[model samples]
Target: MHHSLSTGTPLRVQDMHKRFGQFAALDGVSLDVKGGELVCLLGPSGCGKTTLLRCIAGLERQDGGVIHIGSRDVSRLPPQARDYGILFQSYALFPNLTVEQNVAYGLTGASREEARRRVGEMLELVGLAGSEKKYPGQLSGGQQQRVAMARALAPSPSLLLLDEPMSALDARVREHLCGELRQLQKRLGITTLMVTHNQDEAMLMADRIAVMNHGKVEQYGTAQEIYSAPATPFVAEFVGQGNWLPFERGADGHARVGGLSLRLHGERAAIAHGRIFCRPEAIGVNPTVHEENLFRAQVREITFLGNRCRMSFELNELPGHALLAELAPERMPHLASPDIWVSLPPHSLQVFA
Candidate 1:
């Protein structure tokens, strides 16, 4: 079998728009995927992620804008002419056909020997070499998914589109397959676009993530970039766990949550009211060095999560407003008393106007 990697083609979607009746499914969505990179369209259901993937695959036509795959304008082309392979959520393997026949479904024009050789290569590539004689019904869900992947890659297309490909499997299986799929994609060097609502999967598999919301691309960047510095309130709330403390800008040009004044890292935006956003993990517990945002917090609840524990507490200075702090197992001993010192690092606080 030939293990040579194929060069990937870049994909660009320019100001794409689509709608159904009065509802806009894709509201001016646009993004770029570099060659050999895997970009994930991540969002909740009805967020236009799947629609955008369909538009790129030519299964759905856009009302405006252009779709380019490696310099070729494929916006108006048919699905067959797009030169891309797609894997659906259901695997879509023929139950009546054997694995070999299913993989060779796309190689209709090839001779008998060529089809056989290609089928063997694809099955081996997906780690199902000797299982080619089995039908789809005889395989496990993960095995069926691998068969679908083999069938999709048998054509050797430059672009691969995956639409929630691992959604059908169990949690453990899905996690394992996600790693396998990412490694295979990198090895093949194919420019790929995947639509997934699973944040863990997107963060684990994608080179970059496009977080979609309300039929629009909310933010697009690496996982760390989006998590650490979210561009919008929606992106911050949707991507990970966060603590939002509503604050009022005082007459002294400082922000305060209730009676306690807070210091932000960057220049304060000129706004009367905004929220102080911080991740649970960013809150420090009894730091060795003094911090600007340190305050005495009363422990309200503690949820132990094996490796780490989540402490829900309220600030002594600003009572009634509860905040959460995550602490490592080693730091749990410091919380011996109901009252403990916690610091919300100024740099960790994101002030949104």
Candidate 2:
């Protein structure tokens, strides 16, 4: 793990609200990104992730609420007055100017000599030291993104805002740059907020992820926390691969699904009828009799997903519901029969009320 310099100034947002006519883009959105931490605003389209980022950057004014960068109240300030750097999805580089000029554009009060030095330093930091003379049109998509990042980091702003900065690149390029961007953020120790619809991208780069939906944050937690134990039904369905099956409270006080009464894990949820969710990887196929929560299932479909194979199983008692199991390629031999026994780990099941 990379260590960050503690600045003690977190990005605080309180009761933020934004609206476009009758449609509410953001409603009571609040997040506190600790200094030197990279927090990602992640969700599907129309989830207000981009709108919240724009509001934080002062490009789109919030209809209500306050945004505090460090200790400063930047809610009502113009974009230029706020001490923050922004990187857009388009990699908003100047095609008319060279890379060096573009990176130095934010150094408003710095002397010419100082600006030149800063530009050189930034270009080198982004691995484009010798390409300072290249225009945006001359560079590849990845290179243009690097230039944009360099420009954002040049001024050493108190906060950094990234709005889908790598969405336009190829998958391979995006994956490669995601690691580089995480490393850069750790090394710089700058407070950063990134808005992205890509779950893989957010999982790869964010220190903490704020899962948003319909103008609100549904859940905020570390990657493992969000993946392993989702806070809401929406988070369970959206964050990662999981099987969400409708389960009703049986007369025995256990969750009843697929005509099977199974022992509930953790405390019982408040709602009687909801979903019982668990990750595909947590379910075991054909485990020994010593294991608990065994079920009779038939393999309905098989999907080859590169490193792992996804096996969709239909419960013998509940033919309408399907449970997906992500098994490693080596486990193929263990799943030879369609009517195989499956075990749901006791600790893996979560009730979404």
**TM-score of candidate 1 to 2 decimals:** 0.96
Error of 2 at 309 (Å): 1.0
- What are the Cα lDDT values of the candidates? 0.90, 0.88
Q: Please give the range of 10 consecutive residues that has the lowest summed lDDT in model 2.
A: 1-10
Tens digits of per-residue lDDT for model 2, 1-353:
24456962589998899999999999899999998999999999999999999998899999998999888999999999989889998998888999989999989989999999999989888889988787889999999999999999898889999999999999999999999998998888888899998999999999899999999999999998899878888888888888887888876547888678777765763458888888999998987555777888999988999999999998787787788999898888877789988888768889876
Worst 10 residues of 1 by lDDT: 1-10
lDDT for each residue of candidate 1 in 105-204, tens digit (9 for 90 to 100): 9986899999999999888888999997999999999999999999999988989999999999999999999999998998889899999999999999
Q: Show where candidate 2 strays beyond 4 Å.
A: 1-3, 269-271
Candidate 1 ranges with C-alpha deviation above 4 Å: 1-6, 251-253, 269-272
Model number with the top lDDT: 1
**Clashing pairs for predicted structure model 2, backbone only:** none
TM-score of the candidate numbered 2?
0.96
Residue 311 in model 2: lDDT: 95
